[model samples]
Each structure stands twice: as structure tokens, then as C-alpha cells.
Target chain A: MADAEAKERRILVAVDEGEESMYALSWCLKNLICESSKDTLILLYVKPPRVVYTALDGTGYMFSSDIITTMEKYSNDVAGCVIEKAKTLCRDLQNVKVETKVEHGDPRDVICEMTGKLGADMLVMGSHGYGLIKRAFLGSVSNHCAQNASCPVLIVKRPKSTAGSN
Target chain B: MADAEAKERRILVAVDEGEESMYALSWCLKNLICESSKDTLILLYVKPPRVVYTALDGTGYMFSSDIITTMEKYSNDVAGCVIEKAKTLCRDLQNVKVETKVEHGDPRDVICEMTGKLGADMLVMGSHGYGLIKRAFLGSVSNHCAQNASCPVLIVKRPKSTAGSN
Candidate 1:
């Protein structure tokens, strides 16, 4: 038998509430981590900072009392849902360690920092398949992670024909 | 004996006249491909279109013939060097097929098109690792490929500590 602990590879995967990220997690589980590799899978979910706005600028408008609480609950629910999805994807793997984390910050910065801090061997992420203009308008998190991460990055995008499978 | 032909995988690698791309080729050889996999490595080098300069007043102040020839020769030399380097790295891998391609166009477009056309299982390339401002000013090939390639794309970057190794 191979020394299971001798070749443990640490893989960090960035997941979110998007189907593409979930597909990426599935791809990583199927292709990257082998049954004998004894790899550790760390799932990271970065929650964007919540911003509440009130029309207090001369309009004399105020938000309802339950608005903030509802927003908080919604964000928490989303984070929990994504984590549960990832957990379900990894449940069948044998001899592989799995962990999940939720952090509040920019996705790009948090992912890069966590990769460095965790000494991960590889960082896996999903591409949302945005066009050039859209990517420019909304800064690309996977692009930033690829350029800035301390470890190698694998950006997985679903094939065109398979887009409907998810 | 294993049936090598039955398990062949097509892997497309984007190479340029940069140390980082060469490092990516090395990393792919060490980490991704194995003799048992019987992978076919497609090395692609995209040459940018040559530019012809003209005076603002529409006057014919074109580059000298010798100067244009010299620039062409330099570009050709760089492309040849990169392909030769990639070939040498794969010289020892048994039962693996190696092919080289040189195309003229934008790097991002050519890579994505080639991957789709060739039905590549995976696309591997290196990151120049530009920071935010620089990436905004000059677009990144790896970033574009990550979002547009038809197959899974791996963007490999040399670690910060190994920056001086090349």
C-alpha cells in the first residue's frame, strides 16, 4: 500500500451561490483528486460586504425596522446553502479530508490570502463565462486569483454543450 | 501491458517566448501528465501580427526593409526557441504524442479557437502574474483563456520565492 500521508496535496476551491462554482467543485472532485492522492479539499466562500442604503438625503425616507434583519438572514442563508452543496459533493470521497470556510471580504483578496496562509498546492475556481465587456465592468474574481494566488490556479469552465446539464 | 492507445488524452498547452510559459510546461509535465495516461501534448505559439508604421500626414515614412526583416527574424527566433524548449522537456516521456503549432492572430482568440477545434481535454498555460493596474492596462492571455476556452484551463504561476530561479 502507498503511504497515504506521504503525498498529501492541499487543494483550495472557491465556491459561491452560482451553478458554475458548483460545477467546478464537481469537476475538481472527479478529475483532480484521485482516490489514492490523500488530498485535502478546502472550500472557501467569500461573502460580499453588505451595504444598506436609506433615502435620508433630504427625502426624509427611512427603511423598515425589519429590513436589516431580513438582509442579514438572507445572506446567512445563502452562505449556508452553498456550504451544504459543497459538503454533499464531497461526502463520498474516501480518505480525503474536507473543510469549509466563510469569510467576509473581496473574493479575490480573501481567496489569494487564504491560499497563501493555508500553503495550498493548488487553487481551483470556476469561470462564469462572461464576455470581455462584462468582465471589465465587473472585475473578474477568477482572473485576479489566477494572477495573485501564491499557488497554481485551475479555472474550470463548463463546456458549451454541457451548459444545460447544470 | 496497458493499452496506451485506448487511454490517450489530448492536452493543449499555450506557450510564448516567456520563462513563465516554459515553467508552466515543466509543471504540467511533472504534475499532470504521466506515462500511463498516454497524453498528446499540443504546444501552441501565437505570433502577433506585424505592425507597419506610417507618418501622421499620410507620408510614406515606412520602416526600412532591413529593419522590418530584422524584427521579423527576431520574432521567428523567439517562437522557435519556445517550441524547441517545450519539445526538449517532453523528450523523455514514453508513449506520449507531441505536436507543435504556430498561428498568427491575437493570443487569446487563437488559443480558445484551437482548443475547441482540436477537442482538447485540457488547456494549460502560464500567468505573467501582472498586478491589478497592469492587468487593466494590458489584457492577460491566461485570464481570457480561463473564461473562454472550451476545456478546463490551468494557469500555472511560479511561486514568489522561485521568481529568481529562471
Candidate 2:
């Protein structure tokens, strides 16, 4: 009965270097989680795959070892940086389990797939709130996740005045 | 200071004649709202515009009075039924205000526009949880709202077993 009372909820929060995503992290801390709730936050960062420039015949020179090493360093730095930020934001919440994951793929596909794989009760992410014309043409990550995720998706949008302050 | 503390949160919930949406309403009541929170639920029903058959020359045929009346009655019935269902779900929660509005337009456009106009702090709706292929081809209403709404959007998805049970 004590174990059942501690029903741990898995919450997946997609994070990026963008302030909107960080603001979403903050908002989730403030509004969604409460003292009595047993929650686990999975902070996920999806890095775009390395794009290789190819010649017309589809044959491309292999990247030099130095360049490959530098790219790997950059990728590691970014993943570490974003996850650290998310961790700092959740530092105040005692007893909540936090985990970080980094995946390389299209964010839309990765976010939805990870949510199901992690058995996330809810997926939370930030919306950049692109205007209708821009959103229609460019599409958005949050929109795709909302459409595809198996669980509920909560999109947090910071108010306009405080939008970039994060 | 008291007035500021009592600032009511206008939550716009999009409803339809589907069990998925009603399940979303139930989830909202169970998870999002509380008695201490000043809350107003705006139940919106967007009726798809009546289709008219046009001739090759672009001259459209008009519906007879009986047909038009029948269509109007059907629309009204659906709107009333959905709103009533939402209200009944909230019956146990005392001191929460509920208002209903029925509009004629595409749901995507109407829901976003009304959220801005209503100054909604948040918008809550249900996702149909269509698989990737289906959602990719047939765009979803909740996805569009999450992308375009000025405020945050919480999409409540019922658990699989309990989804259609509601």
C-alpha cells in the first residue's frame, strides 16, 4: 500500500538550447508538479544528424579525423550544456528523479518515439508560438509531437513580455 | 491585491461530438482545476460550414427550407448535447463558472481566434491519438491550436483502456 501510494509518474520534457524550452522547464516546475506528487522528469535533447555535403555523383570525401573529432566534441558539449541547464532548473524540487538523454534524429520523430518508449504519462514542451503563416509553411516540433505522441502533451508558452528574459 | 488574487482563469475547452473530447473534459476536471482556483470554462463547439453544391458555371443550388431547417436543428442539437455533457462533468465542482458558445467555421481557425479574443490563460483539448500515418495526412485540430494559440495549450489524452469508455 505504501508503494502504491508512491505512484511515480514519468514526465518527458523535450529541451533544447532555446529559451522557450528552458522557460517550459521552469513553468513545469512551477505549475505542474506539487509536493505530494512522485514524479520523474526525463530531459531529452535531440541533435540533428550530421549533414554531409556530397558531390554530384553522390560520392563525398570522408571527413578528416580532425574535423570528425571537433564535431564529436561539439555534439558532446551541446548535450552536456542543455542537460545541465535542465538539471539546474529542477535543483529545487526535492525527491523528484531526473534523467537526461541525448538522441540524434529529427526532433518530431524522436520526441514521439521516446515518449512511448519511456512510458511517459505526459510530454511537455515549449511552443515558439510562430504566427499562423509561418507555422503553416515551416511546421513546428511541438505541433508534430502533439499530433503523434501516444500520451497527453502539454505545450507551455511564456507570456510575450517575459518571453525572452529566460 | 484581493482582486488580483481573484483573477479568474478563463480556460477555453474545445468540444465535439466525440467520446475522445468528452474524455478530455473529464481528465481536465480531474487533473487541472481545483476549488481554490478561480476558473471559468468556455465550452466551444465549431460547426463545420454547411456545404453547398455548385454547378459547373459556379451557380450554386440553394437548399429548400425544410433541408436548411433540418441542418440547423441537427447543428443545434449537437452543440447543446456537447455543452450539456461538459457541464454535467463539472457538476461536482462547486463555484466554477461554465459558459457555452457555438460558432460556424473550421475548428482550427475558430479555436485559435477565440482563444486570443477570450484572453484565455490556457486552452485544453483532447487529441484523437491518430497514428503517425493518419495524423500526417489528416491534420489534427489540437495540433493546430498548440502551434497557433497565444496561450499555453494542454492536450488531455485518455488512457487507452479508459479512452472510449467515457
Candidate 3:
């Protein structure tokens, strides 16, 4: 745990296995000042639930094991994409310990929860690489974390070349 | 120039005409600890090229007149959104002015470049909302600003639940 404590001031990227997110992750790894000793590049990806019915129903029997397994598979697929991107981001870095994690639930909550749990000093999120609406783009997850988190939060916007892709 | 110098530390929100971003802009007006006495919220939206064409000789050109018109409409829409959001976000708060800007070209470069030009103390952006990815949602713009800005960048991520949405 103390070893984890040592890397507290490092960068933690919330990735979702996309080229734009990867570009942001790469940008962080390349530009951050982490060479003093060593830092952490914690790559996090979450598996959001496709169906809320089972959760709403609140009964274990409502969902079958097959569905859970399929969800887990989907989670792995997403995580695999994130991990691949992270590896590319870390390809040139030295003295950085890269750790990967895949979780099942809400990404904002999971990421915010992991901030302290992972001993992160600050959080970095890319701006509009994802094609959500401008309103939803800034309001959803980023808004929640900004309002609630105790630590500093970074809300990034991707370039027009990227955001303009629509 | 002196007026611009005195205007440093304004809160710059890259407006993209959305409800979520509007919520974020409003939240910044009310909750920011950076002091409303000397602060203003600068809402900016970058308009992308409407048409991209490769000339016969391989020159890429983006035609403008129509794009400019659309950009005006976009700026008006988001400016209205910011003003409306501010009425409540600030309510009866004192000493803060809310301003909006319409721009053409890259959003990331504009934010970073403006940060330099405005001598901004901080830049804020939303994390994830209506972006392309379902689970991983930090926009690339949020990421780039986090890494490249001279000043601090705040990336806001919101919660998905109705109870947590506010």
C-alpha cells in the first residue's frame, strides 16, 4: 500500500479505448513532469451496464449468469482497448510504472472513487474526443466530479480536428 | 491592452451549445472559489469547417461564408444558453461578469492560445457526457489542456444517475 502511496502525485488517465482518448493519454505521458523519481500511469476503463432492468428490478434472479458473462466479456473488450492504448502511450516513457484496471459500474463514480484509492494527486481527462453533445459533453461525468471531488480535477477538450469529426 | 491585462483570470468555458455544458457554465458562475470580484466567465465556441475540399493540386481548402453564418448562429445559441444559465447559477451573486465569444478553427488550440492571450489563471472543461464512448468519456480537449496549458485546467465529469445528475 505504501508503494502505491509513493506514486500518489502521478497521472491517472480515464480511457475508453478510443484513438482520441489514446491521443490524450499519450499527451499526458509525454508531457507530464514525472522523472524526479518514478510516477504512475494508471489506465482505467469501466464497463457501463447496457441494461438497467436487472438493476432496477433489484433481484438476483432477474439476470441470468449468461448475461453477466456476456457483460464481463464486453468489459474485457473495452479494457483491452484501453490497455492497448495505454501501452502505446507508455511506449517511450521511462521510470514510470503503468498499471491497468477494468471495473464494472459508473465511470465517473469509479474514477472519482479510484482517485484517492489509487493515491492520485490530480485527475486528467481529455476534452471532446468522444462525440457526445456539447451539453452532455461537459455536463455529465466531468460536471459530477468537479462538483463532488475533494482533489483538483482536469477537464480537457480535444481539438476541432478531432471534435469536428462529426 | 491594459484593459485585457486587467481582465486576466476570467473563467473560460469552451461552449458547444449543450444543456450539460450550460449546467457546467452555471456551476462555475456560482461555485468557483476564485473570487467573482475580479472574475468573469468567458464562454467560447469554435466552429468547424462546413466543407473540406482537396484541390486538383492537392491543396485543402475550407470554404467560409456559410460556415461563418452558422458559427454566428451557434455563438448566439450558446451565448443565450450561458446567459440563461448564469441568471440562476449566480442568482443574486455580486461582482462577476459573464461573457461569450465565437471563434473559427481548432478548439484545443483556441483554448490554449487564448489562455496565453487572456493571461488566464485557470481553464475549466467538462469530463464526459454525450461524447462518442459509452464508458470512457474524458474528451481529448480536456486532456490536452490538462497537459499543455500554462495555468491549471479543471476537467468536470458528471454522474449518470437521476439522483446524482444535479
Candidate 4:
């Protein structure tokens, strides 16, 4: 722990096109970033892998190269948009270097790998607050990362306004 | 989020005899507690429920009243010692209100209930870092709290120096 205090900490935050992620980034900025410490905040947006459609696999849907290029472009634009929104949340950060990254892969795998590859001291993400059945069906990204990440993981759960709300 | 910024935050930290928990408290003190914000740090220790042995056609294990009393006293002492150690860790905290609580129940249930009952904005605890088989045998308290606690949960995982180290 003494050594932990002396070195610069790389805090990797996984972001996405969801309000939950933005809320997490905002919470991180407000709570974790110390004014005196040298902290690097890495905002990572993992794009879902592109669909590979073979000629024999499709029933009715056919994709031309132009359409595929358009879809890839849209994915890139979404990643850029999400990163921009996350950056806006960190506008007031002081003594913290903010960096952004966009990677193409499954989020759970990529996030856990990046934490180890980049020597992250901490990983921050948001909980979707899904119900038991929904979480079982969709599989929680934050939960997976919390279990698998090499570094400490901080899960920022957004408070639900009402019991009936998601 | 603006309202959250304006109000004081209640952070509940669960501690035990394990070094993992103390590491979590230290990490929370270093990373989460802001100098300028009004934060209430609640240190909670949960004692396991006393074993109730019924006189049935079972194994030959009996507990005398004196033994039960001594066991209860030991439990009390451990709780006090752990809480005191956690308090010493927070001795240097400024602009933060520190409170201690000792409750009798399972750690997972007691910790989650306390967070909601105390209106905690966040819950901090340590990960045991159990492997799959060990975790199956002994359920993870941090994982349970992370799923059930109403507030955000920050699990501090102590870094293992060697790959073979636990």
C-alpha cells in the first residue's frame, strides 16, 4: 500500500452509449480523482464485433461491401460519440490526465485484458441495475469484470427513482 | 447528481479480522474520501450468529452454558478489537464523521441491510479473491453485497505480489 501511494495510478474506466456509464464516469470524477495524486483516467469504449455473414449462412439478408462499410462507420461514430460524452463529464478534472481508447471486441474480454495490459490500478464501470431474470439473460458486463479484472473494480450503481423503474 | 453533490454522503465500510477488509478500508480512505466534501464514514463489523445445538439424535457435540458465555464474550472482544483497529486507521481523517457499529448476523446480510438502513450512498468492502472452487464452497460476501446492496459497491482487491500468492 505504501508503494501504491508513491506511484502514478492508471484508472481505467469502461464507457459506453448508456446513461448508466455516463453516470459512472461522473461519479468517478467526483469521488475518486484526488487533487494531489498523479492519476491517469483512461476512458475505454469497446465496440461490439462486426457481424460476419457467410454466403451460406443467411436466409434472406444480404450485405454489400458498401453497406458493411456504412455499418462499420456507424460503429466508429458511436464509439466516438460515447467517448466525447465521457470526456465532457471530466471537464473540471484537475491534476489528472484523461485518455480515451476505442477497441473492437467483446466488452468483458477487452476490459479485463486492457486492465492487465495497461497496468491499470483500478477499473471503474456502472451497473445496469437489471433484475435477476434480465441480468441472467443479458449477462452483466460489470459483474464479469469485477470477477475477472486483475485490479480493483469500482461499480457505480445509479439509484433508481422508483421501485417500478428499471 | 447535482443534488447528490450538494448533500453529505454516508459511506458504509464493512470490516472483519481478515487483512483483505482492512486493505479495503485503507483504500477507501485514500481513494474515495474527498477533503472538501462532508462525508460520514460508518465502520461496521458483523459477528456470526451463535451456534444453536439441539438435543437430537445427532453427533456428540455439546455446549455448556459457561462455554457459550465465553464464546459470546470472545466474539464481543473480536468485534471491539477489529473496530478499534479500523478507527485507528481513520484517526487522521479530517472533515469526516466516523461512526462504528457491531451487529450480530451473517456478514453478507448484515452489511447489505446496514447500507439501506443507514441511507448509505456507497458501500465499500474487500474481495476475498477466492477461486471458483473455493468460492463455491464459501460464498463471497463482497459479491453478495454488490448484488444486493442498494448503494454503489466498491470492492478493493489487494494486489497479489506473486502469481502463486493468494
Candidate 5:
């Protein structure tokens, strides 16, 4: 069903194709309500920096052409997966609007920036995403987003043992 | 290491024996530094409900009791383990204050209660702590706390795949 109220309330779900994130997305679908209207679900995924730099005689070297191409391809593939999953979930919800967004750069910075532009009220996200290994080496997107986001964030916790359960 | 400048700052960590909880505790130890002579780490653990019930089978003869145990033995064990871990970690931090407390109730409620009663400025915790099976049955503590907390909360995101990687 289409209506004016359905277009308003916003619930942003940061997806990285992880169990916790999916659980959070599911939770949002089940709990969020706008008094008399349905809420909007936005699936957001931020692609990590693909430009790799090497130390060429102590000076930073530009990313190789092949690496850059591969990075773009990989980012597109991951983003596509997020959109697909969100679409499947949206099919089940009644009148709620579900949209997808993808961006590049720091996950926290991008989310904070987006929130400023889009007055979203709640951030639903899983604590661990597909980039867990990379995050452990550098940092975690969930941590940064929770710390920096202006709005309240729902961090769905998934236990290691339950990784494959969901 | 122990002087007048190390007595004012206090760090409160909600310990639950979940590795993710420890991650938040570690982050607090790394950050939330005190400029003066006071540094205290308070490890708080809230024990959730644990009771046993016995009932009679249908038909004519089997009778059983519906009495719940006074306390949950497993919960106590988890709290004890978390406290021990915190104590061991606190040994190396210089000019820091460390303590442990375990209470019974909902973790989010207990945390808020403790913070209010203690007048804590900041809170650090892992994003999720419920084990796989329990999480499926109940829910994650961090998500609940984020929605209901009155003060600032730092929810540390655990990596999805922290195995084999450093």
C-alpha cells in the first residue's frame, strides 16, 4: 500500500552482510513504528578505502592500476549484495518504504555526515560485519558509528558460536 | 606511579565474562585517562534471573515441585570469571583504581541503576554479551542499554572473525 505517512519515519540500517547486522535489520522491521504510520528502512553500506599505498623508498606510492580496478569491482559486488538482501526483506514488510545507499570513505565519518544531511532518528546495525578481519586490523565500523553518531544506535550483538546460526 | 595526581578519574566497566565486554574494558583502560592523581576502574556485572521450576506430569501420579532455586549458579560463575579477568588486567595499569560489583536483574536496568546511584560520568561496554543460544532466546545487553541509557555509552564492536588474526 502507498501512503504519505509511509514516506516519513526513517530507520537507517548499516549493512555489511553480517549476522548481527541482519538481526538488527530484522529487529527494526519488527519494532519501529511512527504512531500511526509505517517507517522507512534505509540500507546503508560504506565501502572501505580501496586505494592502497606502498612505501617506495620511504615515500608513499600511488595505488597500482590493477589493484584500483579490483577494488572498484569488489566494492560494487559487496554493495550489490547489500541492496539485494534489503530488497528481499522489504518485500515482506507491508507499507514501509525501504531504500538502499552506498558510499566510500571512513564508515563513521560517512554515517555521521549522512545523519546530518538526513535527519534519521535511529541507526540499526549489527556489531560485526563481513569486514571483521579488516576491521580487527584497523578498527571497527560499528564502534566508530556508535561513538560518533548523533542519534541513538542499535548495535545487535552476535556471539561467535552463533555466527553461522543466523 | 602512585601519587596525588592519580586519585580523581574513575573508569566503570560493565563486565560480563563475554570477550566483547572485555574489549570495552580494555578500551576504557586505554582511554578515559585521568589527568590528576585518581584513576579507578569499577567492574560491574549484573546477574540475570536464574531459577528452576518443577511441575507434575499429566494424568494420575507424577508430582513435582514448581519452586525456583534461590540463585542461579551459572550466573554467579560467569560474574566471578569476569571479575577475575578484570583484576588480572588491572594489575598493569599505573595509578588506576579497580573494583568489581555484581548485582541481579536486567543488565540494562542494573547498569542504569548503578550509574545513577554511583553518579558515573561515562559507561563502557561491549556491543553484545549473550551467548549464541541465549541470544536467540533473549537478546543482546548492549542494544538494550543503548536505547535506555541516560549517560554517554561506549559500545565496543567485536570483530566478526577474530580467530587466527592478531
Candidate 6:
């Protein structure tokens, strides 16, 4: 039992375009990943659901399919870019397997669901460090995941000293 | 810079008499601590503040100093026992420095303050898995520390399957 417990672990890390998540990935690499273990690092990026706008909602113009396609392409491009950046950060990892996953949904729900569906031993994500009012308004993904995730959740908050410098 | 980043880290773990905290400590030991790094694990146990009683409106009876002294001694003994149990869990750890500290106060404030004072790189604790109503009434210590701690917070939740079996 001890050997199985200390063997391979699947660590799911939620990443996004924000520097905070990138910092979390870096932090996990530095602090959590052990050189002797065969750890699988799953980098998950959740894209916001596509908005369906209708002409009846006071907008005088009808949206074209071309425009919707362009917006979706932009979202995909952003996801690809973020995943590429995250992959670059993992270039130096040894004895670890890195996988990338991109999904579309509310980040809070998607991240939590993915943690369970993926059978992750642990979930690592970054905290936005939003103040009370802002967090109430915008809703914190990390907080929601921390409460709902089945596995242990690691919420990495970037220090204030390096928040702006990075 | 890379060497410095991969060097020693101070990890502060808040523990108590509950089984949940022992699970978190064991989880941290299995997943977070690396054999090659010089990680210092600080085990902190916070004893709830003693309640003060007054005869002005409560039970119309005055409490004796002996009772208060006995209560204080019991609290100290509980703290000592908890720390001793935590240390036992770390007995197999190698290349890791384990330190124990006991403080008296509300756990939320003490754990957060100690993380800052101790300059911890990460703060780990267990989630009580309280329901919405219970959490609203009891005020979760892990949730508060996750919000207020200066460092990253890892909230470990025991799997429901093994929660009762242990």
C-alpha cells in the first residue's frame, strides 16, 4: 500500500491566460513534483462558454455566422496560445509526463468536474486574490473548486511583491 | 536562481485532534515532501481560547479558580497529545526537519498569522467537509486560512470512502 501510494500520481493543474496560473504551474514544478516519482501533470485550460446573442435583445443588427465563427476561432487561438506557453514552462521537467487538455464551459464547474473525471490525486490552481467585493461580483474559480473538488486542492496565491514585477 | 528556487522550503501544516488533520499531514508527506530537498515541516496545533465565566448573569454561580486551572491543564494536555501524534506521523521522513508549535487562540487567526511570521512557502490544512448551514455557523478554519494566509494554502479533504473506516 505504501509503495502504491508513493508511486505514480496524476496531478491536475488548471491553467489559463493569466500569469497567476502560470505561476501556480511553476510553483507545482518546484515544490510538489518529485524527481523519483512518475508523476503525470495534466494541464487543463477551460474556455468560457460561447455567448448566443439574438437581435431581439435591443441590438439593431443581426449577427452573422461568419462573425460567430471568427469569435470562436479567436477563443480557440487563445486556448492554443495559453497551452503552448504552459507547455514551454514544462520543458525542463524530468521523469514526469505532461498532458494538455482544453475544454469549454464555466471554469469553476469544468475544473471541478475534470478533477473527479480525471481521477486526479490532487488539483493545483492559482488564486486570483480578488478582494471581497470583486470576488463577490466576479466569482472566484479557485474558491469554488476548493470547496467542490473531490481531491485535495492547492490554491497558489502569487505574492504581492512579485505580482506586478512578473 | 533555479537552484535557490529548488532549495529549502518552509511548509506550515495546521493540525488538531481531528482525524481530518492527520489525514492531511499524511497526504502532505506522501505527495509534497521530496527526498532530495531540505524541507522544513512545521506542525502547528492551536488550542481554542479558554472561555471566561461570570456570575453576573450566568447560572448565578461563581466558578472556582481550581476549575479554570484544571480546564487550562486539559487544554495543554490535548495540545501536547496532538503534537505528539503529528510527530509520530513524520517519523519516517528523511532529510526533512520537523518542528512543533502550540498556540492558544482562534485557529483561523493563529494559523494565518503563523504562516506569515514563520515565512512559510505553503500552508496546508484539512477541510472539515461541513455542510452549508454548519459552515455558516462554525466558520471554516481552512476556508479562512485559504483566504487570509500569506502563502499558498493546500486544503486536503479525506476521501469519503475511507473517512469513516479510519
How does model 2 fare in lDDT? 0.73
lDDT of 1: 0.76
User: What are the models' TM-scores?
Assistant: 0.80, 0.77, 0.46, 0.77, 0.48, 0.84
Tens-place lDDT digits, model 1, residues A3-48: 2224678899998887778888888876666665567899988766
lDDT of all predictions, in order shown? Answer: 0.76, 0.73, 0.56, 0.76, 0.61, 0.80
Question: Which is the better candidate, 1 or 5, if ranked by DockQ?
Answer: 1
Instruction: Give the per-residue lDDT of model 2 (tens digit) for B1-166.
Output: 1232255678888888877777777766665554555678888887755542112124466677886788789878977887888788878877678888888866777888999988887788888622233334436877777778888888876667775564
Candidate 4 lDDT over B1-166, as tens digits, reads: 2233345889999888877778889888876675556789999988766632122215776777887788789879988999999999999887789999999866777788999999988888878622333334448987777778888788887767633343
lDDT of 3 by residue, B36-73 (tens): 13566676665433221112213455546775676567
On TM-score, the stronger of 2 and 3 is: 2
Clashing pairs in 4: none
Q: Residues A1-166, candidate 4: write the lDDT tens digits.
A: 2233345779999988777778778777766666456789999998775543223235776777887788789879988889998888888776678999899866778889999998888888887622243334447887778778888788887767633343
Residue A1 deviation, candidate 3, in Å? 27
Off by over 4 Å in 6: A1-6, A51-67, A129-138, B1-6, B51-64, B129-138
Q: Sorted on DockQ, highest at the top, how do the candidates line up?
A: 6, 1, 2, 4, 3, 5
Q: Could you tell me the TM-score of candidate 5?
A: 0.48
In candidate 1, what are the lDDT values of residues B44-157, reduced to their tens digit?
987765532122214556777886788688878878987898899888877678999988766778889999899888889989722333334447878788988888899998
Which regions of candidate 1 are displaced past 4 Å? A1-6, A52-66, A129-138, B1-8, B52-60, B63-70, B129-138
TM-score of chain A of each: 0.82, 0.81, 0.72, 0.82, 0.79, 0.86
On TM-score, the candidate that comes out on top is 6
lDDT of 3 by residue, A1-166 (tens): 1122133355677776445566567545533423433566778776664454255445556667887787668767757876786777577656667778777666667777888688765566654323243224234565455555544476554554564563
Q: List the residue pairs that clash in candidate 1.
A: none
Candidate 4 matches the true fold with a TM-score of: 0.77
| lDDT (tens digit, per residue) of candidate 5 on A39-152 | 667888877755322321235567678967876897789789877886776576665667788988767678767764667665667665446555654466666677567554
TM-score of chain B of 5: 0.74
